[model samples]
Target: MKLKKFIISSLLAFASLTFTSNADAASVQTHRVQKGDTLWKIGMNYGVSVSQLKRENHRTSDLIYIGEILKIPQTISAYEKDLLARLVEAEAKGEAYAGKVAVATVVLNRVDSDLFPNSISEVIYQKDQFTPVKNGTIYNPASEASKKAVNEALVFRGQGSGSLYFYNPQKTSNSWLRSKQVTVVIGNHVFAK
Candidate 1:
């Protein structure tokens, strides 16, 4: 009887310790708003969504005051990171390094935009959204340049543009895409708002 009680107490103690450690590993991070900071930019930097950031901080509007501290919630999963790298490689394999990064940035931008899907995979695999996914090139191994671009994009966020769309103007005859205000022209692709 005494042995059973001892074993039960030990298991309970072990379970408590495991739970505490797991909780500690995933604690939220806080960001101090800078002069040029926006919720979209902040969320990009931290691999979270603007909506998530606002919800965690109890914000009803996008307005974030400079010098205010906001809690940044969870970052992106490893699977999503890999998926973004593959999409970048498939979309901009021959483009310049900056252009590759810009391509990844556009996807991240769309994640923050209200008109697009909320996650990286969703944005990439949306019906008729990306040509690579439709043609099976997205499954190809990611190039080193593409992986680096994804890392840089996550670090630098929008990279000085609020572009949510990009296309190779030479290959695309879509008049609607041409009509959107251009943000930057990197390599063969045009990044637009």
Candidate 2:
């Protein structure tokens, strides 16, 4: 009887473990396109980016009809989002709103690039990649606008200019960085590839 009870407990434990894993594995959230719904509007409504929406739905254009369903990718976790926001807050603290988005994009671009680390934390914390991580400002609470900017960077969904690096020209004399082709100039930050 004791052996049978032990076997039952083991089975119950395995079932619970499987159920927990399945719950954690639930990732996709679907949104059926509504009348007058634009990708930007849908992304804003769902706290995702329009670019992500298009990519996930296999759409090359912004056009979507009513009753069309979209797969929302939640690959980036809350902690990663918060970390990114904090980096934006620290890096582009006094820059324009567009600059803030651009700053976040640099990190995201690195994440996508095979040359850099694959994850946000890895990219941000890698060696001398970001000053905020080195100076410890990355742990500070991200401003509401900064957090919004990070989401917009990840989802605001305009095809990014492929900027891989940004620097304050006034602050950095790194000739190699300055020598790279400049993509866009926003306030004090110069974005380059």
Candidate 3:
């Protein structure tokens, strides 16, 4: 009876080890960032967050130079932790930080929509999705206001009314946009649901 019990235990342990090894093998994959590849795009591809990429790579700025090698996390939990940490840091920077997070959130929303790419990186790097990233906004050094907006959005996270749309009232005179749902009015930006 003791031999039989020992054999069963050994089999169980072997099975557990095999499962663990398989799980670990499936958990991580390597990615090389090519020219025009944004962290957001990579995160989207790996189902992680831009912040996660930044944290994993110890990046202090969102401006990812060309050919930066990044390790993409394979799990949503790890990605969320990375994003939350980055958001917290951005909030510490102020409104501009908040705006950045909010901007990230908008990309995330688009990812959820069938009309947009299925990942953060893809949505952010999508044609005309973000002007700052495409036109050198990320490299322009986030403004105090932009930083603050980023922090606020990170903390607010879909809590400030339902406004998911935003535009510069001065730059855009589109009447249709004006008719959209307005959620939060912060600084020079207006957020709509």
| TM-score of every model versus the real structure | 0.67, 0.81, 0.44
Model 2 lDDT per residue over 1-193, tens place: 9999999999999999999998876755888988898988777666677777877889999989999788886647889989999999999998899999999889888888988999988999999988898899989999988988887787754478889999998989999999999999999999999
Query: Candidate 1, after superposition: displacement of residue 51 in Å?
Result: 16
Model 2 quality (TM-score):
0.81
Please say which candidate is ahead in lDDT: 1 or 2.
2
| Model 2 residue 53 distance off true place after TM-score fit, in angstroms | 2.1
In model 2, which range of ten residues has the least summed lDDT?
151-160
List, residue by residue over 12-69, the lDDT tens digit for candidate 3. 9999999999999776676876887876566645655565567777888877766656
For TM-score, candidate 1 versus 3, the one ahead is 1
Best by lDDT: 2
Residue-level lDDT tens digits of model 1 in 13-56: 99999999988865757899999999877865676656677778
Winner on lDDT (1 vs 3): 1
Candidate with maximal TM-score: 2
